[model samples]
Target: MANTTSAKKAVRKIARRTAVNKSRRSRVRNFVRKVEEAIASGDKAAAETAFRAAQPELMRAATKGVLHRNTASRKVSRLAQRVKAVGA
Candidate 1:
């Protein structure tokens, strides 16, 4: 238990931040899933569009510290590759 008033406030802030981060992470995952589903469906145009939509979201996640820079880069690379493969 947080005995100090400041400590309690810090815990509340942490809880709020956790919810915000979780929402952001979930949103990113949904965007990635959309790209993957488009790829799996073999819709080249849809996959490309989904990839385009996902790129900025992934980059934003990195910028917001929701994801590591390399992780976001790797995800973008992989998604782009899948998009290209389908579009080919």
Candidate 2:
């Protein structure tokens, strides 16, 4: 459908970016899931550790434009709260 050479190149670039973004999003979800699973298992130490790992990943995703900054911060805040509650 793209008749122009530039448009064709743009379509290719978009496809590559889409793949990269999808991978990044999936990675973020996997990190979050790890934290949640640790929390659900009621292992405070593991939950805290997982939260530590996930927090950076979330922020990195935001930095990479995979997520909004506020969304990442909100997720970090909520997960931190849950991690704290796990110890209590």
Task: Give the candidate number with the greatest TM-score.
Answer: 2
Q: Any runs in candidate 2 off by more than 4 Å, and if so which?
A: none
User: Against the correct fold, how does model 2 do in TM-score?
Assistant: 0.98
Give lDDT: candidate 2, residue 6: 100
lDDT of residue 71 for candidate 2: 99
Cα-based lDDT at residue 14, candidate 2: 97
lDDT of each: 0.94, 0.96
Q: Which stretches of candidate 1 lie over 4 Å from their true place?
A: none
Clashing pairs in 1: none
Give lDDT for model 1: 0.94
Instruction: Give candidate 1's root-mean-square deviation (CA, Å).
Output: 0.7
- The positional error of residue 88 in candidate 1, measured at the CA in angstroms, is 3.2
Expressed as tens digits, the lDDT of each residue in 1-88 for candidate 1 is 9999999999999999999999999999999999999999999999988889999999999999999999999999988987899867
Candidate 2 lDDT tens digits, 60-81: 9999999999999999999999
Q: Which 10-residue window in model 2 sums to the lowest lDDT?
A: 79-88
